[model samples]
Target: MNLYDLLARGFPADRSRPAFLLGDGGEVSYAELEAGAAQVAGHLLARGVRPGDRVGLQAEKSVEAVTIYLGALKAGAVFLPLNAAYTAAEVDYFVEDAEPAVFVTDPRSFLAEAQAAAPLAQAVPRADDDVASLIYTSGTTGRSKGAMLSHGNLAANAVALHRAWGFTPDDVLLHALPIFHVHGLFVALHCAFLSGAPMVWLPRFDDAQVIAGLARSTVMMGVPTFYSRLLANPQFTRERAQHMRLFISGSAPLLESTFAEFEERTGARILERYGMSEAVIITTNPLDGERIPGSVGYPLPGVELRIGGGEETGVIEIRGPSVFSGYWRMPEKTAEEFTADGFFKTGDVGRRDLDGRVWISGRAKDLIISGGYNVYPKEIELVLDELAGVTESAVVGVPHPDFGEGVVAVVIGAGDEASMIAECRRQLAPYKSPKRIVFVEDLPRNAMGKVQKNLLRDRYTDLFTAG
Candidate 1:
């Protein structure tokens, strides 16, 4: 069955239930979602999208935008959602590489492109292994790689999380996360759809909006930034969140301080889970058991997580249906990603406790994920190295209160700090641009000439630490 076939399993049971409650006091019910998505699918086909072809969508979050995603799935087109923050130059690289049949930006464009064809209101049955979506993930290599998520991979993870997270029809998700990322789009939306739950959708995370919605919502999934902001606000009282049954943190590491603080404030424990774009969701701290700080807890059902056994923290390798099949059009790299034992080598350095809980220490990759967005140091360094005053540059993530990791650039050359920052802002997305740029005489290097980022990380450890 196609991923759409699996996704529509619960729509019938709650046809009148709101799938999306827009910030503007409007709602899109489950039935409306199916119908709108069908129209979008037909529109995609009319616009020259075919089975297995990629559909590039970069737009602000809306019910219409999400329907377009479902429509692409129904038409069997790979739904590739680029970050709205990505500049046109950055978009060009992905669009050129993926060669999407249709590139959609606004509601008018989506509707106009699909207007010629009638609604494709039914599921387009697909083989389990057929490609579903191609989401880009930056690796330690600094270049972005598209991970090929299959219908089976998505279905398996959704079903597993439904069971693991204890989702039900009664749950109402207070959704504030962006629709582009896997955490918000795939995990949050899939679990809501599969469980026949309604969503109170906010355009973006505003502390005021979240606190107002918390009384009505039973579940809230967010990055550490969301929780930290809520905790920072004096208005986010325990009574305000009385109706909220669950709070989940992911996409970036959840600080131990935030976790303990949240539990203390809410009288309810916030569950911290671990996952990456290569795999939708892998492990989660249990809902019914100890929601441990720093530990992502046991693997979800059907996910096989193993640490490359060593005395210290080891690389986490997984083999399961939920794991992505390969990287898009990169067969050699895909082959190299797996081990002789057939486990997908996750570059995240983690260790497993005796209780089977998993704790992440660091990333083996040089990618910085700030506010749930992937920022490759190489991408930024490439731009910096091109400047007249720069010989070379190294980028590293330092601790941050709100963004989880703040991007900091250490430059080897003497350039006006403002000029370098402004240049980065011109070339890269706002999230990918370094928050701080430091002029260093030389970067710490090891005997093999590899820049010791760990040393730099230690030196600037308090960059974002509060006084």
Candidate 2:
């Protein structure tokens, strides 16, 4: 039941086939990938990493970094990937919490040592329910909790996404995403591995590099910021993206304007899906169907989704084979997140149609209660985004004198505050309209391009309270 074995079964018969096409026009063959994993596995075993041990990696993205992940899988060790941008203090927290057998900051030296060690011939055996990875939540609210993803959890998700996206050996993926996140690590890499396909790998998302890679690649999976940046560049023409078969967006909400303008510019609709760190990928807009803007489409094949509170719109709860068992070492906290009936409460506020389509409004934490009325930030932001002179907007609730919380709109482009407020007043209820519009050149964002609303809330907490 080892996940490494399942992925290995899909390796190309001709091991000479390219698995990674690097930026320097060099190629890493499938045979080399397998060998690297074997050596790394052996090195981990020699270093006293047992089957259930944790292997923490916080290095920059590279072929060696990916090999470490596969190596950990082969050794039956739980992989813990962290963002490279985290400070020493931040790394300290994860270290004290997860306590990996070996935390490697210098991957190049580690790979050198691994290459010199004896190679393990095959993957170590693991049960289906054995923990495979620990994906820590972003922890905007409190301390980060490690989500325990089992071998069965990851394997089920990998296989489901592989079929849904229609991967084939002939496909050449333009891989520009960071490997730390689920969108890049599990979803993108698994699809390519499952089909024995090659990936035109880039260090990160660069407009020029991505445009050039598009000529030789058939598929591209990226966050919303990647698509928005591409559209901003004049070189990203229809002809440049004409040959691409799929452009999938996730890890953040895609602006409807970005969705429409991308279609207008490239003549291809971006497939936007919804997922989080707890679950790899829960729902996706159809690979072949009407990909309605603002909809995350339907639940994956075996997932059972329901709206909590039994309203048209409430919290989304899900139960499935891919849903993680619980958070690592947080039994009480884990119990609080799941329903009594066993559904994992996805703190996102959304609704499901009778036909099974799902549309996410916003995060439950982001919901604003103003003047004794509930106000959803997404609704206000949607209206603000459509107004003139506004490139984008983020609506957040701040402490107020009159209302319990005042609706404040933080905008990204030029606009008159009074005029914008008047426009909002016309379209929305008085309480729903922004009490103050704070214009900023750019909104605060995390690595994956999701607006850090918590930061926004903190930054403007005194907006209505300052004397």
Candidate 3:
């Protein structure tokens, strides 16, 4: 069984129903979506992509990008989506590591070539345990590990979210998030696909475009940045968002301030969910019940969640069908990430309330979630240390009103902040670059001689929020 087949199981009986409502007021029907996927699948096969081979794609968000994802599934190939914002240097690392059978940089040209091939009549067969996707998440050591998500994993999470969110064909999703991350690629797209609902598509989150889509859409899934940006504008008033039925946020911690302000402005509380690339979605606030600020509600159906060490608040561990199988080609690393009992260590510090609701306080790892993108401190630190006139650097995430967390670098060196930042932007994705740099004589350290990032974080807690 293929994951695409599972997604199609919930499609509306009529294939002519609109699937994507374009920003220009055009529509792509479900039948057209199917045909596009078929063509792409046929082309992938003709290009020597086997069932288990990886198909890497780094392109701007477009309808063709979505079709490539579906096409990969139809061809039984592992879909590897790289962030479009990734620099060529960053993209080279993923290309060298994943070694995809075919990598497409331009979706329009790729789609044109795909259209010339005969459409595939049927989807290639796949097993439940077969890897469907490889989502690369950075380790604390500055290395990227590919999380291999199986067909069963995606199917299970999609089914769970579709039910939990109460999606239906009547729903119209306001799609604005980028398709590279799990939040956009799997969680948001799967729910809409399972319900056979139409998505009012936007290339990216634009204040004007989102305001326009909100009127015609029933649901919106975004990062905290989206809501924060919307609230910054006077046009995103209660009246403008009165028709929206659901506003979901994930991929970054939604600040309590944003949550309360959004509710005050829209007369609706945004549903916050918890997830990672290893697992598409783990927990979410209830759709029909109360959605408390800063609370990620409960684990999805069939998921077993616990705080590691059995303390009131500790590292979160989970065992569920939706959890990814393991890191690709990293058996030792995968084994270290899981418990003897098979629970995956989430590395996130959180507590489960007596009522079973989960609230994430912070990450045990120094993972900065800036504007919904994961920025590993080591990755940035490595780049910073390699730069000219650098002695050492510690990257920390502090509170930011817009980005949820703003990346800051404390350096003990003689480099100009502008030059260092410019150098970093050249090698890394924009989001991963430090927003601000502070030169220091020395970094705070523990008795063990390890850099105390906690001290750095505490010292700069109000760096962005302060007047």
Q: Each candidate's TM vs. the true structure?
A: 0.79, 0.99, 0.80
lDDT of 3 at 352: 89
Instruction: Go through the candidates in order and give each one's C-alpha lDDT.
Output: 0.84, 0.94, 0.89
**Ranked candidates, highest lDDT first:** 2, 3, 1
**Model 3 residue 193 CA deviation in Å:** 0.7
Q: What digit string (tens of lDDT, one per residue) describes model 2 on residues 108-170?
A: 899899987899998999998899999888999999999999999999999999999889999
Candidate 1 residue-wise lDDT, 255-332, digit = tens:
565687788898878888889888899999998988887789999888888887654566789999899989998999
After superposition, which runs of candidate 2 have C-alpha atoms over 4 Å from their true positions? none
Query: Which predicted model would earn the best lDDT?
Result: 2
Looking at model 2, report the run of 10 residues with the lowest lDDT sum.
108-117
Highest-scoring model, TM-score: 2
Question: Model 2: what TM-score?
Answer: 0.99
Model 1 regions more than 4 Å off:
12-14, 112-116, 309-312, 366-467
Better of 2 and 3 by lDDT: 2
lDDT for position 135 in model 2:
88
Model 1 weakest lDDT span, ten residues long: 443-452
Model 3 pairs whose backbones collide: none
